[model samples]
Target: MRNASIHPRTLGYLGRALSLEYSAVQQYMTQAALAEAWGLRDAADRFRHETVEEMQHAERLIKRMLGLGVAPNASQLRPAGLAYGLVELLLQDAALEAEIVALYDEATNFCRRIADTENAEFFNALLQDELQHAAEIETWLESLGVARRTTEDERAYF
Candidate 1:
């Protein structure tokens, strides 16, 4: 049997990352339902698709944690403060994506510093996905003439 050991800190980070991923899935699902209720079928479809992607990400992370012999924990997720409206939903998603991007960036850096090449590569790919998600949402918001931008002083996470 091959023996692989993961740092305790890395395991803790993975646990936190898993929670974030779970939260994202829930948020996307809520957003999708809200869009459908508001009679925006296209928007709802997009949100649903995004939710599926988030779920997949969570599963991947879970598998990685297990492979590393780390116990996976699902903690309560942070709430996303969002008002009830289409514009609000889009803006919230964009902001959330940005936060996720920042998180993955940090994780990647940490992995590299610890010489965890595999995790660093994985996080780098996740960061790219997050950036794309943010860009897509921003484009949609801009098309709707909703100018949304996050300031540096704003909180890093939702």
Candidate 2:
């Protein structure tokens, strides 16, 4: 934490983002384990990789909070829901990424309002990363030929 002043609203948003990132890490890790148990080795690996990325995002938020003299709060995490199958898991992941993208967008705007150019840029980059994650999940789902209509079809289970 530095001696410089940080906007309270900016700090609050960062803390929320940190907690969300922690939740994402937990969700991805749990999904990875579930995929492995279901014999989806490739999906498991991808989930595990995403788990690492979420952890890294959390670390970045923590470091930023510390640099601003604000304590990082990872305690208010959102509960992660379990998916019954691979398509469901992918849908959940895409939804999670979309939520994260929205959060980062708000955070970036908040940082801009506070004249915190550095943090604004950081959040922007994070937003880009999350968008990419969501896009990849969408592509994967499409590759499986799982359209919206087939999302809940028990026969679509792989």
Candidate 3:
């Protein structure tokens, strides 16, 4: 692909994605430290793993932006969602994963609509990964007896 011109909206989506991914990395890293301080070593390790995964996602987004000849700037990163307990952190993570899933899904659809197979495939991969992460979190919640189908006003666990 020589001298390619990426659509502005697509760039917007990519930037938004990079921001969310980096935010997730921050969230998970903070949660990991919190868990460690609380003496939940296993939970801390799990969050650390999540941090790495989210970091990988951000890296991929940066690479994609560069491939499209754009500066890889994650526009804004949200504050890390913090909680005192492991379950609370997991709940926050589940909600974040839901948001990521929606973003990737929408981005993938937009790319497909514009007949950009490469970008569509990229977004779809991220979508699949986030979906799996969401499912794992849901299962973890279930295992801990904290899983509940959320009400209309609540963030969904599924």
Candidate 4:
């Protein structure tokens, strides 16, 4: 293992990513419960599975930080308060995934610009998963028609 000191900015980025992963785990678990309450069995199962995946991502980042002699930090994680409706919950999750995609893409691009191929690859893999999650959520939302109805209702009410 190269004892090369990871750049401070890179470490900061990784720390934030770790925090995000932790937050994702929490959010997915919560979503799973909400889905179950709403009688969305398949969606509940999917969220539960996603929670596990998020934990795995957190573990991977923790290992990488340990290897680089840095302590993983979770202080930057944002809290997701209670979601009211099913549509609200799903849209919140989708938005979170979108944010994650943006963050991962930025981190990977930074790594590539600095010639850090390994880190770049890691971020790219995570980004790909985030994008897939976003797309899946979008598809689910379309099928639910909640977003369309919300928009139409808002326009009519306003």
Candidate 5:
């Protein structure tokens, strides 16, 4: 492996991100399969599209790691929860996206602190992507008359 000149923490974050991206790919694909089994054609298609997008994210992270002379690690994976219904799936996806967005935001801050503007920008872009996904999921959930979380609940947390 080529010597990655970046800080160790930066490398650690990138590796974690790579692992998460791979996990997302697996999760989305599995969701797609489950949707198909449940005869939810539209949901299945959306999940498949999400699976492809997650794969693309993983590929980009791997390429970036390799470019930095670091080997990408995908070992830090967790089991993807198989939601019971369409509404559950949307809620799960929204939560997952929110988690990823927070992680990427932290990574972006770390990159900026280390003066790696390029990586910081990359992480920021990922954050935006995830935020959009989260918003879409929330909208769909609301349209389906499923309440993942109420605004009052959020207010209580603050």
Candidate 6:
């Protein structure tokens, strides 16, 4: 039986969030392996760390869904992004982080508009985490002398 506590729109948000988090996990894990293949140990290590971070996010989302009396379902998972160079990989990751942050921001606003304080707080916390991740990607890009990328149509809207 479906729980009546969560708004349907919020449920959609939660599902999409889970999908995006898994997408991040897949992307990062693949990048880590690629980095290792290319003998970029440092890059590989960083990607591995990112993979763990994203997995934790996915787990948290799953637990929240379970607590809400819903069977968690991530309807779609995007393919892992592949790149021949470390810079290219980081650029893709930066774009992905931006997309995730945007989704969480929208979700938070929607929950707030519906006066769902608990869900609003949930989305807001995730938003903050993603924002920090994005900022870190930006800083890494800056340190590498590669300016942040401007991508059109990069967002995989769920």
In terms of TM-score, the best-performing candidate is 6
36-140: candidate 6 lDDT, tens digit per residue:
999999989998999999999999899989988898999899999777898898888887888898889899999999999999999999888888788788788
Worst 10 residues of 4 by lDDT: 149-158
Candidate 2: where are CA atoms >4 Å away?
1-4, 147-158
Model 5: per-residue Cα lDDT over 27-73, one tens digit each: 88889999999999998999999998888888888888888887778
Q: 12-51, model 2: which lDDT tens digit per residue?
A: 7787788889989989999999999999999899999999
Q: Pick the candidate with the highest lDDT.
A: 6
> Which digits, one per residue and each the tens of the lDDT, describe model 4 over residues 1-158?
43565667788788888988999999999889888998889888988998998999899889988888777777877676577776787788876776777788889989999998998998899888887887777778888885533333223212
- Which runs in model 4 stand beyond 4 Å of their true positions? 1-4, 146-158
Task: Look at candidate 4 and tell me the lDDT of residue 55.
Answer: 96
> What overall lDDT goes with each candidate model?
0.80, 0.81, 0.88, 0.80, 0.81, 0.88
Per-structure clash totals for the candidates: 0, 0, 0, 0, 0, 0
Candidate 5: regions farther than 4 A off:
1-4, 150-158
State which candidate, 1 or 2, has the greater TM-score: 1
TM-score ranking, high to low: 6, 3, 5, 1, 2, 4
Off by over 4 Å in 1: 1-4, 80-82, 153-158
Backbone clash tally (model 6): 0
TM-score of each candidate structure, all chains considered together = 0.88, 0.87, 0.91, 0.86, 0.90, 0.92
Candidate 5 lDDT (Cα, 0 to 1): 0.81
lDDT of 3 at 7: 74
CA lDDT, candidate 4, residue 90 = 78
